[model samples]
Target chain A: MVAAVKRATQTLLLAVTGAVLLRMAAGDSYLRYVNSWMRWPLIACGAFLVALALLDVFREQGSQDDEHDAHVPRAAWLLFAPSLVFFLIAPPALGAHFAERAQSAVVPVDTSTEVDLPPLPEGDPVPVVLDEVLLRAAYDDGATLADRRLELTGFVSRDKAGTWFVTQFGMNCCAADATVMRVAASGVDAPPDDQWVRVVARHVSGTGDGGREEPEVVVEQLELIEAPKNQYR
Target chain B: MSESTRQDSPPSTSGSTARRAVGLPVQAYVVFVAMAALVMSQQWLVPRLDSPALATWSTIFVAIVVQSIPFLVGGVLLAGVIATLLSERALRRLVPASPTLGVPVAGLAGVALPGCECASVPVASSLMRRGVAPSVALTFLLAAPAVNPVVLVSTAVAFPDRPEIVLARFLASLLTAVAVGWLWLRFAGRVPILHRRSTHDHDESTAQAFLGSVRHDFIHAAGFVVLGAMIAAAINTFVPRSIIDGVAGNVVLAVAAMALFAFVVALCSEADAFVAASLSAFSDTAKLVFMVVGPAMDVKLASMESGQFGGAFALRFVPLVIGVAVLSAVGMGWWLL
Candidate 1:
């Protein structure tokens, strides 16, 4: 009888888990809304538990005989009790404190190459690394071409007067392993730290003073923008 | 058919009658509610905790639970089918008699069939019923999740820069599993729970047995998975990561910390690599230990163990695996990357 009951419970749980996964995959708005509010993974777990419950129900009805009668130990139940209690109470989200401590202090970049001379089409976005910007003038041959403007969008990673680096965080698994990829913006309005923004700039010639490894972006304009929904890659 | 005739009498005892009337229904209701509550809570909680860190953690947790469901369903079903279709004599013949050979073979079998921690418990139980040596069954239980192809592949993917971590995890988990099994056979006596008679005396047909086994395995594994997820969710909510980090920093302290993490996290072997990778602050060794030990020893595994092997056996066995796992992880970390 005990075995039957256990099986029934397990079936019910499995069915529910499948349903929840389906819902999540379907992009249920409520689920998405709640995902924004809490953690989506927790929702996924809840769904799995429901599926398990359903599996249990099915198993109980199907298997009348208890050929596999393994007795559950009291100690195992005791061990499981505390975890159960904690699940009942929803925990807070990870905060900014982790962000500061988790920041990778060392930025590893190769600074040996110096490639010069490529004119971008009008209004085309030019990819500039910090090291690349330091080698030559921001603009080729010191001439500000007519009707040319570069527009770029990224998060405000670092800020200085008239100069800042727009950066994005790339994630492999979770936020815990996020790496920052930054681009320098010079000749533009600098925003507050960590604010996502759009910058409109005219490429200025590089000073050639900054180390060949650390190039700077020279922006002619900058504007702050709202942060995107998903910050990590 | 013969067993059915014997059971028709109902054994005519007041205690047995009361147990039949009250025990089954009460247990069933409890299981039902437990299942409902766990799923409901997980659904409700996950969305409310949104943050990149929280989302990632939750995603890893969910993926683990989600990915393993199919396998768990299959394993439980297979076990149930075996129970109904195969006669005791047939099963005995299928399993090796000798403890020494059986245990190591079972442990090595884990290298082939990778399952999540929850799935393994039921599989282990099924093996016990087939008359495989308890020690051997135990070895398979510990090693299957860690050494399986899916988990190994996932580990490799998670740590693309370091391939050696995958090899290290496989060797360490395999060693721990075999070592524990050998120890159990040498030290432990005959376990009573495994000796319990088969419940299916009805002489059900092969097809029925197959369906029944599938249903049974699904239910059994599903319950444990839910239970495990709830535990992990609870830990994520209440236990601060700082505490985990603080404890996991010391080389010796990290092993014990990971053992405890293994108990609480209940991560599937395939998804555990991501979780391990996410803990960038933790030393590679500690992380490796977490991957190796989490699948083998955890609260979910303990529940399944109690259900399958009997409480007395689980009581001694889980801790034994945990200790060996920690030692193996630490020792391997020292020798390897």
Candidate 2:
């Protein structure tokens, strides 16, 4: 009976893990934890777990149960921890609170010889990712960003002095490698922390030589938007 | 099919009747149901988790566990194959008898396997189980994940500007692996870790033994990973990481802080160089220390090793690896970088 329970516990844990991976792969939820490239491995591992569980079921019924009935140790119960977490909590993604804790380091993502970015789109206001905006303002050789209205969207984070920065974390592989990117937004009252907001603004000179503060965008118009399906860039 | 169905179906008996009345056979069932209920109504947790510390904790905990599962699966599969297919005679013949000769070969051989820390734990355990020398297997265990081709390539990519950083990593990581193996050989005496050998029982068929080994290794390693991840999350939540910021400028303090940080965060070996590089405040040496100390011994590795070897083995083994790893990183940092 104990052996049967052990097999049952193993099967249940594997099945639940498989289910979690499957769900994560089929949706955007996994982006919070790992890179998008992990989708295939996640699916493959999930399938393997489910298949292993099925094999256990066959073995359990094949008359191998009665002979090896060792007492299930209490430690064996820990195997269910991930199963419980996956089924019950299914923990959420990194949020504003993590953004508040960042000093900042832009990982040099492109190792190949530096290729110039394509010419900025011509318009009154252009849509740019929060990361691209930060990268260009800091690293770009050309001053293509001068006097151009750009639209940027990210969650709101406010400093102690009642200034808000349109902030986002750029992730390379997972939340573990998440780096903070903040663009100070003026001409608008602060939105509540963690609220998704869009700002139509132009670059404002950030004269600080130190790395902490990046260029700001002066908001001409502010609009709140729903958090996107993929939270991390 | 009938037999399986019979096993799952509850027999009509007084004991089962009593269980049915109470909705379970033991008090543990009430706790399980309560946990499930708490999960269903997790709104209360959201408010408590709204704090930055808890939120970061949750994110990191989820990240580590979810990120490593595929690699752990790969490890278990490799281990299963090792247990069933690689006969003890073949393995003994394959590995050198002398620790002096075998250890370096095992360390160099680590370059081929591509896995993170968790993946190597089971494979090492299986090798030891199959009658290989403990030193050789342990050397491979540490080196395989930390110095593998995938990890080396990732390290190269992460530190492209400084080719020396990549060289320092390879040399230091391999050094740590070899040093630990030699230390184990001299210090551990002649006691081999005995995992409960259901190996004899499962030698019935290749397929059966393979599945059995897979079931055993996966369950054991994954449980410890869960436990280790929870502790890491707690440390992440309750402890302020800003303490390391103070020492980032001092070379000695920076190395110490980075090593401790590596232990605390337990970042995946393949992904850790990127993280180390991201801490731009630290020097090249500090990042080297972070990469070296992490894959060799961290919270997750500690738990996984303890799960595979005995608790006593982990207690003795981890600190030694950390010490050797720190010394090598500092020495290599001074010499190479």
Candidate 3:
């Protein structure tokens, strides 16, 4: 009886786990946790687990009786926790709350080759990645960003001083290694915390050296937007 | 079916009455109800709970677990192959008897496993269960995530200007692995965890043994990963990194801080170099310590090690790896960086 219960529990756990992975991978929800490239690998892994569970069932059925029940440690049951948490919490992507804690982080750039800053493409309110805006502001002596209106999109985050900044996380592998990038938006009433927004702004010179203090920008326009498909770059 | 029919009778008359009322055994009925409750909570109860801190914690926790599962699955599949197919004679031919020779070979062999630190624990444990030397297996465990080609290339990419940073990381990690393996050989008296076997039942067919080994390895390793991820996520969320950054001025303190940061954040080896490089406050040597110490020992890896090996083994092993890794990174940094 104990052996049967154990086998049934294991099978159920594996099937549920695989099903959840497939469900997450089949939709955009997985982008909240990992890189987009991981979709196929996740699908493959889920399929493999489900097949393994089925194999276990068939193998057990073919056998006569449980004489030597394989010992599964109590720790194995912890496998259910992830599934339980996923179903219960439905965790969103790392956002304003996470960015608030990890504020004003500098993205790693190639410092060895100091090349000329690329000229901004011919456009008013040029759409730019938040990291590049900060990088050019800090490192480019030419002040390439001066007199150029830029368009930036990020979620809203506020520091202890109640200063609002447009914040985005740059992820390398997963959310675990995400780094915060912020550009302070002035001359505007702040949107709701964690609200994704698009801002057309020009750099506010003399406000930041981009060391600990993030560069400031005077917002010419602000529009609320839904979170992007991929929240991290 | 026969076992359940013969052995599953209720213990009491009252229990039997309830079992008949449910039309299924109590255990099965309870499991069904619990699952249904969990599913229902997703819609009705969980949404009303409004705490940003808790939600952030859950996101990070889920991310770590979800990110690690694929790598863990790959490791167990390889371990399953090892458990069923590899013969003791073949393994003996591959790994030399002398610790002096075998340990270095194992460290070099870690280059083959091009995955995260989470993957190496089960593979290393499987090696030990197959009668490989514990010291040698431990060396592979430390080196696999740190010295693999993917990690090295990622290090190079992270520190694009300083090509030496990549070489320093590779050499330092290898040195740490070998040094710790030799230390364990000399100091470890009797680790019962190495002797505990999850080898296949002799009566089972080869296919059954393979499947069973995969399941066993996956369950043990994955469970510990969840435990580790919870602790790591809590620390990552609660602890302010600015406190660690404040110590960057002093050389000794900076190195220690970086090592501690590496252990707590528990970043993947492929991604950690970028993180280390981003901390512009620290010296190059301190960054080296972050890269070296992360894959060799971290909160997650320590938890997994304790689960695979024994708690006593992890208690002894974790600090030793950290100490050796710090020394190695410092020495290599002075030489190469």
Best by DockQ: 3
lDDT value, candidate 1, whole model: 0.58
For residues B1-337, what per-residue lDDT tens digits would candidate 3 score against the true structure?
4234324433453344344445533444566579878788677868775578777888888888888989889988888877789988898998998977999999999887797899888888889888888899999999999999999989888877688999899999999999999988888846557444553355667887788788768767887788888888898788786786799999999999999999988888888998888888899999999999999999989988887787889889999999999999999999987
In the order shown, the candidates' DockQ scores are 0.13, 0.34, 0.43
Model 3 accuracy (lDDT, Cα): 0.81
Tens-place lDDT per residue, model 1, B1-337, is 4344335534433334444445565654775587557857786765665454454344334533444455565566556655666678886665567888777777777887756666676767776766667788888888888898988888888787688898889889998999998998888856556444334434655655455455445544454565665566556545665687687567678767877887786756666786676565678898888988888888777766665556688789888988899889888888888
lDDT of each: 0.58, 0.75, 0.81
- The digit string of per-residue lDDT tens for model 3 on A107-204 reads 43444556677888888989999888877776543177889999999999998889999999988888887889998889999999999999999987
Each model's RMSD to truth, in Å? Answer: 8.8, 5.3, 4.7
Give each model's clash number: 65, 0, 0
In candidate 3, which residue ranges exceed 4 Å CA deviation? Answer: A1-5, A61-71, A107-113, A206-212, B1-29, B194-196
Q: Count clashing residue pairs in model 2.
A: 0
* Tens-place lDDT digits, model 1, residues A111-221: 343434455444455543322332233233323322345565666655333345666544433332343444556665566666777776554443322322223446766
TM-score of each: 0.62, 0.87, 0.91
Q: Which stretches of candidate 2 lie over 4 Å from their true place?
A: A1-5, A60-62, A65-76, A107-119, A139-142, A160-162, A207-212, B1-53, B89-93, B198-203
Worst 10 residues of 1 chain A by lDDT: A29-38
Q: Mind giving the per-residue lDDT tens digits that candidate 2 earns over B1-337?
A: 4344335433443334344345532334444576568777776664554455655766777777888889899999999888888887787677887877889989998998888789999999988877778888999999998898888889988777688889899999999999889888888856557565543353256777688788778877887787777787676556655776788998888989999989987878888887887787788888899999999989989988876787778888889899999999999999998
Highest-scoring model, lDDT: 3
Candidate 1 docking band: incorrect
Error of 1 at A91 (Å): 12
